[model samples]
Target chain A: MSAHATTEHAYVPGEIAKPNTAWIWKTFWVLVIITAIEFAIAFALTSPDWRTFRNSIFIVLTILKAFFIVGEFMHLKHEVKSLIWTVLIPTSLLVWLVVALVTEGSFIGETLSHMFSS
Target chain B: MAHSTTLESSSTPIYADAPRTGTWDGGNEPFKASYGKLMMWFFLLSDAFTFGAFLTAYGMIRHKHGVFVGTADKFFFSTAHWPIPEKVFNGFPGLHGMDLPLAFVALMTMILIFSSVTMVLAVEAGHRMDKADVQKWLLWTILFGAMFLSSQAWEWSHFIGGSEKGLLMADGSVMHGANLATNEYGPPLFADLFFFITGFHGTHVFSGVCLLVWCFIATTNGTFEKRGHYEMVEKIGLYWHFVDLVWVFVFTFFYLV
Candidate 1:
């Protein structure tokens, strides 16, 4: 504890911070636009095939929105690259795992029904 | 009942940060993250896994049920495809008996996403060292967050109060509200999972609001200004944004999909 120096009297600059009010507004608008598309798709679609297509679109848009919120709103984009990957790679694995498990689970359900129902 | 007794003068292994060797060697963050930020990121990752498990289980069960069979005439009252999330969460506030179909939750999602924007604005204000603006944005963020929690409370009440008397279950039995043994909505697991996942996410939002309250107070009290930086606000912003991100997934799985 004694080894650490105090930062109470640390340097201060007159510029404060690089105020990018424009960028923040852009991010807010992009999120709204994506959500607008999601609502539109939700109300407009009807058939099962189109339902599947709409589901894919919703998932893609969601991932896109998640990307923006995590990268920009959370400021992970400004952080060092290594730190960003440290969070992203494991999360990708998580998504893959969910997909694999759900697929296997559905197959098992089908197999079990075939075995017993007959 | 939840509290545990503290041990007398504990040290070494239980208290140690680890051996401090190799890639994670002594004092250096090679990752360039502060202790607080690194810990929050790891916590969020673990939490992501927990939510992942819940949603995956939901997918498996709902898929097993196949396409919805029941009539869509009565809609929310009559049972349909258990996998059909849009049918399940079709209630709207104030205007009861109207089949708005995901409209209420759509509003909830917008409320949450807007709060995330406010939180980001607060962080931006913090960056510029504008305490007044930071306080203003934090206040708005907290208000929106609380508004969301109240909306969730209303939704829960409507869910628990369910279809006046009761709805018909898969086995033709009538079940009311929800419990471990019975569920009016498809399988018993349906109601159970809804309560658990949304309940868990709701708990996090509640805590995030509390955190915002603290940050708001600290900012107003001139703590960040005195400290010469608003790193604390940034840390909490990460947390706030994470809560919003998880909700997006929950909304997709529970409502849209």
Candidate 2:
């Protein structure tokens, strides 16, 4: 609060603010552990029948990693709520795009198979 | 005459003469961020869309090829099926014949995350206006970024060179390496998507390193110190972290999935 006041009237670059290094380390460990789990899944689950299930796990883990990297690392979690929503609301539309394209692509794949058989 | 001019100008002032209701008014920062930081967030939002489109296209193409309902041994290096990523990215430096899968990429991912940690530390130091601390952390960030780029280069070269046996095409021609034209691993589009997405991400990392260097120099020359804030470091830190964030998705979709 005082930092904001000082910045408004008489800015002080040498203002002794407490650094949040511990939070950085905690975030770092979280990211590392999540990545390790991903690697383990990639190697341990090798059955082709498990492809869909494995991919789902991978996607969930990736989103978790993204949450930490963006929220904590980028400081969005601490930013104003409006700014956070502004950034997130639009990107959420990508989920729709992914589903639409994947469905469309499967249709084309079926067409290719029919033509080849004919 | 002076009083008349003042009244004329004050008649339609751009900002209201009345006191602002709260911080949301034009008189204060509603978002609690500077204009530059807000613009950076918008820019990153746009950039995310570009990457989103690219990755979505990759998913489309991979699905079009159809998934193989067989063992990975049968799927590996099969031209009729989509190549398993672990099989394709199994090479490790200095280990000629080992079939180590996803190991090197795991290392690369750790390197990037470490660099991100350093970058955040730099920003934290900047908050305290500690010049030496900021510089130290920035240097480490830059070095780790370069290391990640170097690892990517090695991976790219390995991809371009293809495997020793190579794939025998339907036309009886053995394709040795991958280009935009054909791939020894799988469909031509597979290589194309790999090239475009990873290459685009590499370009971002390259530019991020350049930006970090600029920030380091500016810190050394007391630019942000003179400006009474190290907000520049924080700005570049955002970009660096975004790059790292994109890699998380790329690593999952491109390599693991």
Candidate 3:
């Protein structure tokens, strides 16, 4: 760990690692392919009946893309398990918020539609 | 139970036995991460919540107002329902009167992803302590960032400048383009949210570009070399990746889904 005198905090960075350019290219390809698939679905699948299915596919793929970006690009996956958990645990609350919003928003929508109709 | 020991005459503190090797007892780095990196992670975590809240509210509003509930090509704009996003974002620059949907935004997404790749490369070059490679990759990242921002600006202007004829309001007025008060596309709030969310993300991207410029200058001057490490690049790389990550979701929710 080498500390820099210029920085006020004097951060001691961890490890002298080698560069992995191949991994960077691999991640780039994966992101591009995922985005291509998303575009394909958006353009090709145009049936109203497929709206929910299409949305589901997009959501799942977006989450998958998020996983790769966060895990590999951000280097969070290689961090110690404790550090990973610290980040993930707090973010899990977002899932709860999603669920709550869906339920509440639908209820509100139904109520508003009914009220305004009468 | 408190254990008492006689005070030692040595220079070592009396509480030296208080297990510090594998814990946050100040004897070691608990996360095995430097203080700066850890703080950056925490800052990003908080930032994630801010964005999460924005998107969640968007979702709620979308559900509340109700959507057009049709495929991209079959949708029509109306004030009573949420507009189909693809229809609103259909036009590409210099391709007026063409009904290409999601293509331009997809290009924007690719630009951001490419920039992210360059950012990671910069970080990797930093790991190798390769100054030339770091500067090269940072330059590419900054260029891609500018490209993305310019594309976004054109998109916003296209949306705002109105397309097709115009939508008629109940008050005998034609809402030609979008603003906080009204929009030709659909509900007024749709444009409002678009401006607010994308504007906020654009601000982040702009700030990120400034930071990259600073990092580029610092690299050119051999500041990190003198400091014996390139950890600053890694820190900034984390922020750049975060901006990309947010764009990923924005592209999904706003354009695709």
Candidate 4:
């Protein structure tokens, strides 16, 4: 209501007063580049020694992609620090959950292997 | 004396200095955010946890199966019996005779990512208040989303129905498609996990598509124009991107890993 009088003469129906599209394009390109890297990692590394390394790289790349989507596309990147932390801080614990569960699950596999072989 | 005082207060008008009974006091905007967008953010945060738990369970079980070595059986699924993600996901669409591996899924991912890009453009248009532009970009986004959903359905059917030769596992057993019990892939657990994770993600894609359609109608039909704001476009854009974001992880953990 306060804005109604100030912009009465300049008001336009279909556009922001000033538009910026560069960031959207930049984000799109970044996602493409990361996905390309993912494909490269998928087929290029074939050795068992490389398996763990490759998987870690993929996880990192996946996180990077998520960052762009959340930060740029979702516009959280521009939001205030409180809004950003409200999101990122607690989700960090979820990452811990990933680490803990994988470790325990590996132990279960090892136990099963021992039981079956014996 | 207290009853008499209350009667006096009512008669004299306790709130006489202030106006009463109109609209809400709305509440604080700590981050200069709107109520709707903040709620959406919180909703997305809770959703992240749900997907996180599912992926964690996946990580746990697959780790137990052991890390993948080159051959299908040793780490993946040998007669030794552990599942390899790549082996199970190796099917290519239409080109049945050859194993194109992750090619088809990669294509699906591209479609989804591209759809996300289009959605961003639509929101951009909305920002400009360009109704025609918003409609055009939104239609494209909806198209891509629909394509993705249809392709997913085809992929699901092919997996469930399987191929004529069936999957020849490292165990020397031939299995067809997947079931709750077992499939040629690896263990019954592998089948269960695949169904659960992908199915959950697919449902989100389906919902996003529906949201896209609604947005398209609202954009073309002057809904936002009437309100004098395009925040709805921005809100749905948040959701569309989230769907794509989740798929990025799914593609990594389920297919790539």
Candidate 5:
């Protein structure tokens, strides 16, 4: 069979079409806007409690950016549902692991600090 | 009559050299089964584990060492007493007397991020069978990767070259201001961990540059024309994006946190 013939056999259900450039461009601009906001939060904010506020915002925005890249740019949305879930499930688990480990580790360190210093 | 027919069929024995009808080969799922792309995914998965292990080690070390003196308490509710990332990374040639905070490293981050964008564009172009766009974007990606690597090298040299005061030593190992064996910028294990982790990442980037160069050459020579597809570009895209994603974690854990 010809190379083009294989498109008919693709595991994906929808038409295996190229992504819309205009939509991609729009998404890119949105990502840029979000990044700019992140920089502003990191640099411009001067509140005594800014770190907590900024960190929360940063994490949320980063997740959003990652979702866009994976779902849209990488065309994971068009793939078989099983494949999407297979990738996403593990990724989510890993993210959770990183957060938990880092937080717990910090707490332990803090406790150690108090123990040694006192 | 049935016996006679069977005897004739057996006598007319099929040739051993005849090809099978449903054999697995190049034609099976041709569009989606590019070897290069498959290899890329495998490479990415392995690379992800490496980064995971490094970050986990970092966490373990941080757990033991506690936080840096100026960073831990001062960094939570307020950014006030936080150890400035910029102050730690402000070295640049011809920019003497200027105290730039994380400026160069930030630029390097942008370079890697933008390179990822270009890599995706190249993959997209490949899908459209636009060889020219593939070549163009691949070249851009290569340039970005090279630039980022150079920036990282400079950062490392600045770090190891030491400041005017030099690294304070106690008991023959570098000690922080508080006279503690380790402080939050990560334990002494931190300096070692940082070098190893980033060095491994830099090696990947260097390899990526080589791959991009190869891909560029292949595109120019119309290798995909005969094959009638661009799966190689997609494969490389996976590797490039993985690098960028790893950096996001590094920036957060090592710099922000």
Candidate 6:
């Protein structure tokens, strides 16, 4: 194949020939703002009953961070829609498994401790 | 005759390098595979599984232990026996003798995350065919990565460099928190597990630093420039971002929980 022809054919349809740098930078700044908020929440909050609120906030922020990292940084957003789903679904499953296992494991530990003391 | 002439005039140009008709879906498919990117995705998938297993095992052990260690009464902050993560990681610049609490680790986390950003920037620069920007961002990423590794090294030293037992005795055997057989913190197993898990993570950071350094040198040497694409930066970005992502879970499970 001729070099020019090869180069021309390399352009995949629906792919942005050039990404918008301004949009990416804007998103990046937004992420930075969220991170600052996270640090603030981590340090400044003093409520005795803040655990639930804090955890929920952290989880939500973290998911948002993950979305930007995957969609923008990883360029997954630019890929085929099917491929994006392929990656996200399995990742969601793995996250669920981690939470479930950690909860069950902690429960067992508590039970064993109680039994030993009794 | 008129229809045929119009059709001939408007026919699309078929390049020699283009895949034969029917080889790919219709005319445009979104999922294009280059060898490197495909491999990166697969590697990331496997790594995800490994992390999931480790975290699951951690959960099991934590549950089985039942009692928290290093509570405020026994150590500092929080009533739970689980060591206060902030207290355990409170090293800070010019704050000697002050228990700053999770300050250093938080800083390290920021540094690593920022490096991930730089890595993506490098990949973006590559997509734009801007060699100088790619080089600049990759250098920044490498510097950030090195700073993180150095910080981790300091953290590890602080962890292991506390007063050594039996130093004056005839046999200078260093005693860790406890042996692997029996002790508080869930039968000494928890300590071993902690060391193994964090140590493994440290090794990954160490190796990642080396890879980043290698990539930096290659970029400086104009390797990516000659290759005509910055996909290599994107490839490393995947690995770098994965490291950062894993640390998120580690922080949640090991520190927050």
Highest DockQ, which number?
A: 2
- Candidate numbers, best TM-score first, in rank order: 2, 3, 4, 1, 6, 5
**Candidate 5: which stretches are off by over 4 Å?**
A1-20, A45-49, A114-118, B1-39, B68-84, B171-186
Which residue pairs in candidate 5 collide? Answer: B67-B184, B68-B184, B86-B101, B86-B102
List DockQ for all candidates.
0.42, 0.61, 0.47, 0.53, 0.24, 0.32
Better of 1 and 6 by DockQ: 1
Indicate the residue-level lDDT of B34 in model 5.
44
Model 1 complex DockQ against the native: 0.42
lDDT of each residue in B1-257, candidate 2, tens digit only: 23332334446544434433333344377787887788899999999999999999999888889666678876656556788888888889999879898888888999999999999999988877888999999999999999999999999999999888899998998887699989898889889999999999999999999999999999999998777778889889999999999999999999999
Q: Please give the distance, in angstroms, between residue B54's alpha carbon in candidate 5 and its true position after superposition.
A: 2.1
Compared with the true structure, what per-residue lDDT tens digits does model 6 show for residues B1-257? Answer: 23332323446765545543342323343456465776787788788788778877876765555344322435432213444455456666566667776778778878877887788877776676666777788888878988887887777666544322312222444333333443222245555666766677777777777887788788788796666555677788888887877776676666554
Q: Across residues B1-257, which tens digit of lDDT does each residue of candidate 4 receive?
A: 23332333356444433322222322234676766788889998999899999999988987787444465434434334556566666677677768677888889999998999999988877766777878998999999998998888877877777656666765777877778876765667777887888889889989988988998898778998777667788888898899899999999998888
C-alpha RMSD over true interface residues, model 5: 5.3
Cα lDDT tens digits, model 1, A2-118, are 111114224365545455678887998998899888888877875565767988999999999999999898878878898899898888887777788778877876786688676
Q: What tier of docking accuracy does candidate 5 attain? A: acceptable
- Please give the CA lDDT of all the candidate structures: 0.78, 0.87, 0.85, 0.79, 0.65, 0.65
Worst 10 residues of 4 chain B by lDDT: B19-28
Which prediction has the highest TM-score against the true structure?
2
Per-residue lDDT for B1-257 in model 3, tens only?
Answer: 11243333546554544543333334466587777888889999999999998889888888888767655557778888888888788888888889887779988998999999999999877767778889999999999999999998998898888886779889987778788888999888889889988998999999999999999999999999777778889889899999999999888888777
Compute the lDDT of residue A5 as modeled in candidate 1: 16
Q: Which residue pairs show collisions in model 3?
A: none
Candidate 5, residues B200-234, lDDT tens digits: the string is 88998898899999989989998975676776777
What is every candidate's alpha-carbon RMSD to the true fold? 7.5, 4.0, 4.8, 5.2, 7.3, 7.4
Instruction: Encode model 4's per-residue lDDT on A3-116: one tens digit a residue.
Output: 222233344643355556788888989999999999888888856678789989999999999999999899899899999999999989997898889999989999987996
Write down the worst ten-residue block by lDDT for model 1 chain B.
Answer: B1-10
Give me the displacement of residue B255 in model 5, in angstroms: 2.3
Model 1 TM-score on a 0 to 1 scale: 0.84
Off by over 4 Å in 4: A1-19, A116-118, B1-27, B67-79, B167-174
